[model samples]
Target: MRPDPHFLRGGQGGFGLVAAMFVIIVVAGAVAAMARMSETQNATSRMAIQQARAYQAARAGIEWGIHRALAGESCSDTFTLEGFAVAVQCDTGAAVSLPEEGRSPRFVSLRASAQYASPGSPDHVYRQLSAVVEKDD
Candidate 1:
């Protein structure tokens, strides 16, 4: 039996086409995965920045409260730091209650509540911090 000229020349032309398609598919998938990972990393960095801003805002609120308590001034307003805002309460009402053993007579409790926008959203993110400021006597 004599072989056909086309088959004798090469029967693997379609195989090469199929292999090329497979390689293209794999490369496309890898590119997509890398894009997703890059987006995730950028989002994480943004969140870290927002968290740092909120913490600084909270610290500012604490300082403001301490100053108000020491000077006998009112400390019941929202204070802004950078782009973050905080609510301060520096009175005897929500004072930091100490355990019976380690109570100090010259201590004042400072409470601060901070609210800022989420890194990728318009919704707010809230944080609370409390400290006991000892008198400078």
Candidate 2:
């Protein structure tokens, strides 16, 4: 009995199938990894945007507090804008004596904080700002 030479020349019958399956798996894994990386990058970009918005809201609150303090009005309030919430507070310090001035001058400290959260996100972004203003009188 003799084996057929043609069968040997044709190569192993199952080798091609195994090689094809391996290539498919490798390609699928690479694709999945790329998708995960893209998702992570998108999330990072979104967080950066959220942080910027929170900072802007905090700055606005600070400006509001300053305006109210200068106008002799209430300087504390909480407000919401564009999905962000801002809270502002002001503290008036005791007057300080000045050598050149007849009357003492007072100082006001303003603090502002802003917070924001995106839908379906568990984390929240926050920003705070503070400033000290002196009365001209």
Q: After superposition, how far is residue 114 of candidate 2 from its true place, in Å?
A: 0.5
lDDT of 1 at 86: 89
Give, for candidate 1, the lowest lDDT window spanning 10 residues: 90-99
The best candidate by TM-score is 2
Superposition error at 13 for model 2 (Å)? 1.1
What local lDDT score does residue 3 receive in model 2, on the 0 to 100 scale?
97
Residue-level lDDT tens digits of model 2 in 1-137: 89998887786778989999999999999999999999999989988988999999999999999999988889999999788888999999998988786878789999999998654665589899999999755
Please report the TM-score between candidate 1 and the true structure: 0.76
Name the runs in model 1 displaced over 4 angstroms.
Answer: 1-5, 93-106, 118-124, 135-137
- lDDT of model 2, residue 127: 95
lDDT tens digits, residue span 4-92, model 1:
88987686768988999999999999999999999999988877777777777888898888888777677667867766878997655
Q: Work out how many backbone clashes candidate 1 has.
A: 0
RMSD of each: 5.2, 2.8
